[model samples]
Target: MDILSDLWLGAQTAFSVWNLLYCLLGVFLGTAIGVLPGLGPTATIAMLLPVTFGLPPETALIMLAGIFYGAQYGGSTTAILVNLPGESSSVVTALDGYQMARNGQAGTALATAAIGSFAAGTVATVLIAFFAPALSAVALTFGPHEYFSLMVLGLVASIVLASGSLLHAVGMVLFGLILGLIGTDINSGEMRFTFGRFELADGISFVIVAMGVFGLGEILSNLENEQGRSVTLSKVTGLMPTRADLKRMVAPVTRGTLIGSVLGILPGGGAMLASFAAYALEKKSSKTPERFGKGAIEGVAAPEAANNAGAQTSFIPMLTLGIPSNPVMALMIGALIMQGIQPGPSVIEEQPVLFWGLIVSMWVGNLMLLVLNLPLIGLWVKMISIPYGFLFPAIVAFCAIGVYSLNNATFDIWLMAGFGFAGYLLRKLDCEPAPLLLGFVLGPMLEEHLRRSMLVSRGDATTFFTRPISAILLLLAVLLIVSILAPAVRQKREEAFTDED
Candidate 1:
């Protein structure tokens, strides 16, 4: 009842004419970015960070949060129509969604994704409202050792769940960690991996790397393939799935929502892990697993739901503990910091209106996505008819402009182009980029926590293993390692990642 009253108060704040307008603007821009094939929430948000400086904190946050979730909703449109995923979370969607489009079931595929997302998002929001406070209390008890172990688990899970060879994924993670170490040492103020370059002394901008690796890299990879055609959105008949389709999807959606909610609360799992895990679980449990890559509706629904749910729940850690689970959340934290608002346990109590207002706005944002997505999907489908040759060049140009816009520096454009080419080579070698992103985000934080934990323990490493939460997390990490080493599990994992024949 208290939660409901708080939510009502929040709605009052979020539904104001001005606030709603910002929400709409964010969603509108987010959809545009998602449809553009390579741009994502990260790049889009990073680009707009400067503009929000003048807005009130709640309004700024509402807009940014709207973009984050709105992009998730819109990302599926391209994944279904063009086999292009705007976000890593949408990668699994591309597998079955693009197949469904080719098979003339684009409408059904998209409808399932949108509806499932709406359902899961609604449920997750309620869960978050009730659970976040409790979870925040739990988080308050965590010491530096516990936090360090959690970070380690997060890094391990990211590497293990990445979509490529185990060794390759680990290598990519290490590379990202190295990239993360490029800035001056925060504790010592000593230059580390700047390589004596003035521009690098501040470390590579998150915007630069995200734009280069995902945005420009996608364009360069597209250029490597001369097959330049998207599935035509000529015939979309069904807007609703049949009872039979619904029956098949029910279990997957339920399981996915559960899995995503739990994993999303864990630092580093976020939307990408949730979506991938949901798909993997669906495949494992399916009677006709072979149907997955060839346009299984469950594949579309389960992962879409899980990803959105994960994206929502990921906010819990950031809101409660002041720890960002992913880069997007990190950006949010940055936004909050800019406003002189520290995200921690006290936030909900100290600023009830802001906290509740944000929660209410999420519900509003979800509703807007459903209303907007259902109608706009057809428009998105039509974009498939655009020629890939023309599209790739535009994508390349967009990447250059977006990356350069950060500091108005041409250096970023060149850097992105270099990384884009490098990304192409990595993809050719069957390496995964998702783990790299996770590692880059977590590496510095991990080092800081590790050092802090060690100092608190008087330089004794045993503290990490002795703490109950830390011990459990370490055990889970060990289990993950053992599972990867297990011959049977290894074989299945290998087969799962190998492109469906």
Candidate 2:
């Protein structure tokens, strides 16, 4: 009963004409960015973040959250129509979705992806509304020691979750951690890795690294690939799924929603991991696994569902725990901190309207995505015909502009370009960038908590293992390392793991 009243209060706050307009604007812009290849939510949000400075904090957060999830809905449109995934999480959609497109079932693929995403997003939003308070309570008990250990567990989970060689994933994480350590030390005011450069004092900008790796790197990769014209079918076909397709999708959607909603709460579990894990789970559960890559509807349905669910639920940790599970959430954290709102248990107690209004707005934004996307599929498909030369240069421009906007520094622009070249080389070498991004985001927070715990314990590192929660978390991290290194476990892991799908 109390929950209902609070939700009503939230709706009242979110229902204002101005707030509604911003919600629509956010979803509209999000869908646009999602349709265009290489402009992901992170890049789009980073670029627009400065503009939100004038809005009230609640309104800004509501709009930003809408854009974040709306990208998940729009990313699949590009994947199915052009075999170009706008977001990493949409990569699996390319496998079966493009196959369906090649076979002239593009309309069906697009429709199903949209519907599945809507369904998953709706369910996850409802779950978040009810579960967030309870989850925040669990998070409130965590001290610096516990938070530090949780981050360690998160890093381990990320390494395990990353597709590719375990050693390579660890190496990427370590590199990210090292990169994160480049700025002035928090405890001691001395710079560690500045190397006599004044610009290095502020550390590597997250926007620069994200834009360079995701936005610029994607542009370069797309430019390298020869353009292929859309293969149209001779006859028009139905867009709606058949009875058999619906039956298969039902189970996958249900399982995916459940899996994604749960995993998305954990640090490092976002849309990309949700999609990957969903594909793996679906494969494991399928009676005929051979159908997975060859126009399998379940392949399209599951990951789309999972990624959307994960996208919605990924807000949980950021909003409730003040811990960002991914780069996108990290940016959200920065936004909230800028607003002078400390995101954690007290956020809800102090600002219930903001909290619940954001949840209610998610449902509204998702409905908008479904209605807006279905009729616009043809338009989005037409966008794929735009020439790469015309398209990629714009992306490059945005990357440069966004990086420079961080500090309005041309040096940062040069730094971004340097990283772009480095990212291009790394991509060529088959090394992944996502884990590195994760490590970079987590490393500073991990260090902060570690130092705080040590100070409380008078410089005893053993304090990490002395606290119960921290002890358990550290043990789990150690166990994960040992399991990955065990010869027999290594063989099984190698067989089970596949490259980014």
RMSD of 1: 4.1
- How many steric overlaps are in each model, in order? 0, 0
Clashing pairs in 1: none
- Residues 95-154 of candidate 2 have per-residue lDDT tens digits of 898788777777778777877888899999889888898888887899999989988887
**Worst 10 contiguous positions by lDDT, candidate 2:** 228-237
Minimum summed lDDT over a 10-residue window in model 1 is located at: 225-234
lDDT of 1 by residue, 1-501 (tens): 887888888989999998999998888777766665555787567556656768888899999988988888888888887787767789999999999989888878888888888888888888889988887778778887887787778778767666668898889889988998997898899989887887787788765676666666656666665444465565576878888888877888888888888888776577888998999999998889999999999899999999889988888887887666776786787678667886667788787877778888888888888788777766766664566676666556666666676678888778777777776777778887657776776677778888898888889999888888999989999998888889998898789778632
Query: What's model 1's TM-score?
Result: 0.81
lDDT (Cα atoms) of all candidates against the true structure: 0.79, 0.80
